[model samples]
Target: MRVLMVSWEYPPVIVGGLGRHVHHLAIDLAGMGHEVTVITRRPSGTDSLTHPTTDERSDGVRVIAVAEDPHEFRFGTDMMSWTLAMGHSFVRAGLRVLAGDQETAWVPDVVHAHDWLVAHPAITLAEFFDVPLVATIHATEAGRHSGWVSGSTNRQVHSVEWWLANEADALITCSESMRDEVNRLFGPEEIQVIHNGIDVDTWPFAPRPQTAGPAELLFAGRLEYEKGVQDLLAALPRVRRTHPGTTLTIAGTGTQLDWLMETARKHKVTRSVRFVGALDHNALVAAMQRCAAIVLPSRYEPFGIVALEAAATGIPLVVSTAGGLGEAVDDGMSGFTFQPADVAGIATAIRKTLDDPAAAAVRARRARDRLTEDFSWREVAERTEGVYLAAKRRVRHAYGRPTIIERPLPERDPGK
Candidate 1:
């Protein structure tokens, strides 16, 4: 099957798990003999002049990184407008790439769009090609804001998301929790739940030495408010009481970094809480090995890929039973679990791991053992392939043949 993937983020420009999800999915799909073409943006600090809309193959996948349009746009300041410009740029790039060299277009059997960011291009390209559009709603704006579409920005994003959900022929969610959320909100005819997967070999089990000076706890993922990083910091003061030398190291960057740092200061755990900023894959895996345990205290995680990464690394996990995290890391059996935003609960769970390092190691081992059956990339790829087939079938049966209408074009030539 030839598949066209649309996404806003990829490696080197990764904002969160969506980038990693698309990268791995495309690679594994290609490995399975599927022709995978990813349409994404060039990394920041580069443009069409320098970057020049690259079309290269990486790890068995054809990646076409489109340079942004030369416009007066700043992502942080002009988020919604930036997103609109990005989607239009993506549409143009997608058409350019699909209209292959020498008038031989490399048309895909299906167009798979990831998240709301690339919705416009996804819908447009799918319609232009008269193919099925499969959208994976990574997370909703309402979900991120905890069911409140407050403010103009939130409402605008939510509206686009709703439009995308309705337009797509088939919809997929990264978790069962997310499937439910989409069903409740959009009332989509059907939504498939495919949990995010990770490569176990990449994250080998190398336990941190039990004998430590200060117990090191790690919090990864975006530092956004919904991620519960602030809540994790709030729990640090109490965690220090149990293990006086316990230190917290935060990995990953977000809008909440300054606020979280201030949160630690206010809690008087500034000395203990250390923000290491964002670390690359090698550095992140290394950090995982060096830490005593990994704490992912997300308040509204759709599906915690980091939890799977932690499990793959054989690190003891203390995750809140928020959204799909509950499925990723089982309470007590695999790792300890707590309710979201419960500072006392978070501290108690951390202290439990610190109290008995041996017991925590046992749980960590169990978590690692669960990865093969639950979170393997091979399984994820196979499941996703099934979805692609189903989406095609839906297009064929439900919609029959897409009506092809060729509109006459009037040439705008001054010479003529």
Candidate 2:
């Protein structure tokens, strides 16, 4: 099947998990023999309205970067104008692709959009090309702000999300919790729960070298309010009372860094906490390798990919019972789950693992086995392909016929 993926972010221009998710999914789809084309916004400082640059990866996926106008966007107006501009750019690129030589003039069987950022363009292109549309709701504006669309910008985003869910032929979410949320909020007709996957071989699994000090606890992700990093910091003092040699390492950068540091100071655990800002891929893997255990204390996590990555690295995980973090890991068999914002519970879970390294290692091994057995890119791509086929069938049935494009292809040599 030929697929066109629309996203606002991609690698080297990622602000969150959406870009990484799209990158891995697209590559795996290509590997599965599907002709995948990705359309995304180019990074800042690039020329607006410049010709889109198309790069074909060795995995057979073609990525087309369309420049976005940086100066014309502000807070509340950003999403609207951005989507309009991106939709225009995508339409232009689609025309160019359709105008190419016979061998290169390919049309997509399905147009898949990730999140609300690209919803407008995805809907427009699907209608223009007369194909099926699939939209993946990674998270909702209401979910992110705890069911409160506080400001004008957030309300606008929420409206767009609702429109996208209603417009798509089928909806896809990363977890059951997300599916329920989408159903309650937007009421999509059909929704599929496809968990996010990771590459198991990406992280090295060798035992971390021992250093002469406390057992290091790692919390890697955005240091935001919803992430519950502050709660993790608050739990550190309690954890230290039980295991004085234990330390907490907070990685990732966000708006709450300063407040988190202040919280640590207030808790008087500043000495026991180390705030290492953002980490690249290699550094993140290395940190996972060395940490005694990985803790994700999220107040609201639609789907915790970090927990999956940690489990893949053979690290014992202690995640909060927020959205999908609890679903990602077994309570006791694989790892422990504590209630979100429960400082005592978080500390107790961490303390138990620190006290019994053998038990923790056993659980980590189980988690790793589960990750390898169940969560893999191959399985994810196969399931995603199934969703695409299902959506296509639905569209065909609705229209009472198969989609056909009668445009002329440019004449050129077949073996160009």
- Give the alpha-carbon lDDT of every model: 0.85, 0.81
For candidate 2, the lDDT comes to 0.81
Least well predicted 10-residue stretch by lDDT in candidate 2:
399-408
Q: Which pairs clash in model 2? A: none
Per-residue error at 233 for model 1, in Å? 1.3
lDDT of 1 by residue, 68-156 (tens): 88877778888888888888988888877777576668988999999888888898888888888999999988888667675667777
Decoy 2 TM-score against native: 0.89
Off by over 4 Å in 1: 101-103, 393-416
Regions more than 4 Å wrong, model 2:
48-52, 70-80, 98-104, 208-212, 393-416
lDDT leader = 1
